[model samples]
Structure formats: C-alpha cells, structure tokens
Target: MATVAATSYVMYVILRRDLQTKLGWPLGAVCTQAAHAASASMWIFRNDPNTEAYTSNLDSMHKVTLGVDSEEEIKKVADKLTARNVDHKVWIEDGFPVCIALKPYPKEEVKNALKGLKLF
Candidate 1:
C-alpha cells in the first residue's frame, strides 16, 4: 500500500481592483483592506487544522492575493465559497465590500473556486 502526503494549506485573499481604478483608493488603503480580511479570517479559523498547519509553518506560509473587478464580483465569489462551506471572512468598509479572505485550505480543495481572478 502507498500513502500520499496531504497538500500544504494556503490562504487566498481576493481584493476589488476597482478600489484603485474606480474608487481612486491609494495602494496603502488597498493593502490595509487585504490585511484586515486576512487577519479576520485567520482569527475566525484559528483552531482549524489547516490554519494550525499554515501558521505553524510561518516561514513557508502561503498566501495568494487575487483581484476581482468590483463589489458584485467579490460578492459572487463569497457566495460560492459559502455554498461550498469554505471558511472565509468578507471585509467591508464604509458600508461597501472591500475584499475577502479564505481560510487556509488544501491548494486543490479551493483552486477551482478562484478561477477568473488575477494576481493583485
């Protein structure tokens, strides 16, 4: 019999590109939003096994930041993640959605869910 090693966990942060092009938000503000989303998700899933593995390996912790076009697009992604029962946090500012952070998950487990997004 043979055994396979589990895939390493990854955290995915999706930000709204419009924050810059449409809203004229500075790079620092956009970065802050991403940080807020990532921190919130990590705190919410702190006890999750995948999160535990990801955090314990700080030097190799994997995080991907992708970009969506607008708030509607981000909401759609959040909805899909919710339907798949993926743990995540959606950060809103001034009553509008800014970005989202998905809890650490095996790369293969959440890869398809992020299709169509581009690197931030």
Candidate 2:
C-alpha cells in the first residue's frame, strides 16, 4: 500500500476541459498549461506562510487538480478566488485563459472556493 502523508495545506490546479474535447489541443500542450499555472503561482506566492510550510516537505506536499468546462468557467473561478484574496495565478495561452492554480493554503480555508470543480 502507498503511504498517505498528512498535511493541512493544498495546491489547487484548475484546467479547462475543452482543451482536449472542443479545442482539440494535444495532451502535452494542455499539460504544459497546467505546469505554467502551478509553477507561476508557486513562485508568486513563495513567501506565503502556507506555501513555505507546504514546500518544506516536498515529498508530502498535497495538490488537487480540478477541471472546468470552458475558458469562462475557469475565469469565473479565478474571479471568486481573487475576491476572497486567495493567492493564485491564471495561465493564458495564445491570448486565451486555460488554467488557474492557487497557492498552497490550508485545505479548509479554500475548499469552498473549489467546491464546484470536478477532478480532472
């Protein structure tokens, strides 16, 4: 059995589902947007307390990836998070938004903000 690491913090990665279905983007390219969103958010909030704690134990760091139906859907989530002062980054490709990643934060503090998303 694999070990489960306990931690209070989590990184939320939200990607556009249409990238694969409607947009016909290659899998690798879609994955790259996720990478860009995550890394950029991590760098931007590197100094946050939760981020510091989350990175301190890299092996146990927790991440949750969710999917949205379209660019507008993803942007809606980002707006909600921004209203709550939740640190995050939205990645844009070719002038269209495709992904959003939230900085590490206690799961409880951010769960409701992400309650509407489905696992990717």
Candidate 3:
C-alpha cells in the first residue's frame, strides 16, 4: 500500500507538469489532479478575472444544440475557453453554462451568468 501510494504521488506530479506545459491546462483544472490532497487545495489562477470567459465558453458549446443561428457565436466562445484551458458544459434548450465547481472562481463569469445567463 505504501509503495503504491508513493508511486501514485510521483506520477501525479509528473503528469500535472506535462499537462500544463502541453495543454495549457492549470493543474487544478484537471479532475485527477484536483482530486489529490495537494493540488486540490491550491489557489485559483486566472488570466482575466473580470470576464466570464470560462463559463461563457462552456455554456456556448455544451449547452446549445446544433442548427441554431447562434451556433457561430457559441463556437467562438468555446474556442476562447479552450484556448484558456477552461472546461464547461452547455444546456440544450438555452446556452446555459455547466462547469466544475471550484473555489475563488472567475467572479466575472459568475456575475455574467447570474444576469439571467442560466448556469448550472
């Protein structure tokens, strides 16, 4: 058990670094890393704190179904979020934002979603 635990910890660290450098995803953003003791407690990092770029991106892509007029716009939003390594989900009825819950989230996205943006 001890050996397995130690090995897991080492692998986790290595993978975290690789993912960040390769995919630009923050260590905490990944579910595996986030589930760990160390990475789970880390502080949130943001490139733009004043925007809902993350939520908007997820909502735009995952929430909306195909054949909508706003598909282009939503795709753009999703692209932006992907560029930033943000993950989210969208609603089929109305481009609602679904996302992983985290502490100290991008305040701007919360505010934007709060304004009748439909977040879940």
List model 1 lDDT by residue over 67-92, tens digit each: 99999999999999899888899999
The estimated TM-scores of all candidates read 0.92, 0.92, 0.24
Instruction: Give residue 68's lDDT in candidate 2 (0 to 100).
Output: 95
What are the clash counts of all predictions, listed in order?
0, 0, 4
Give the backbone clash total of model 3: 4
Question: Could you give the candidate ranking by lDDT, starting with the highest?
Answer: 1, 2, 3
RMSD, candidate 2, Å: 4.4
5-110, model 3: which lDDT tens digit per residue?
1111110111122234545656555434334422232223234331223333433311111211233444454455456654333222223321222322333443
Assess each prediction's global lDDT (C-alpha) against the native: 0.89, 0.88, 0.30
* Candidate 3: stretches off by over 4 Å: 1-69, 92-104, 108-120
Q: Which ten residues in a row have the lowest lDDT in candidate 1?
A: 1-10
**Residue pairs with backbone overlap in model 3:** 52-109, 62-90, 63-90, 63-91
Minimum summed lDDT over a 10-residue window in model 3 is located at 5-14
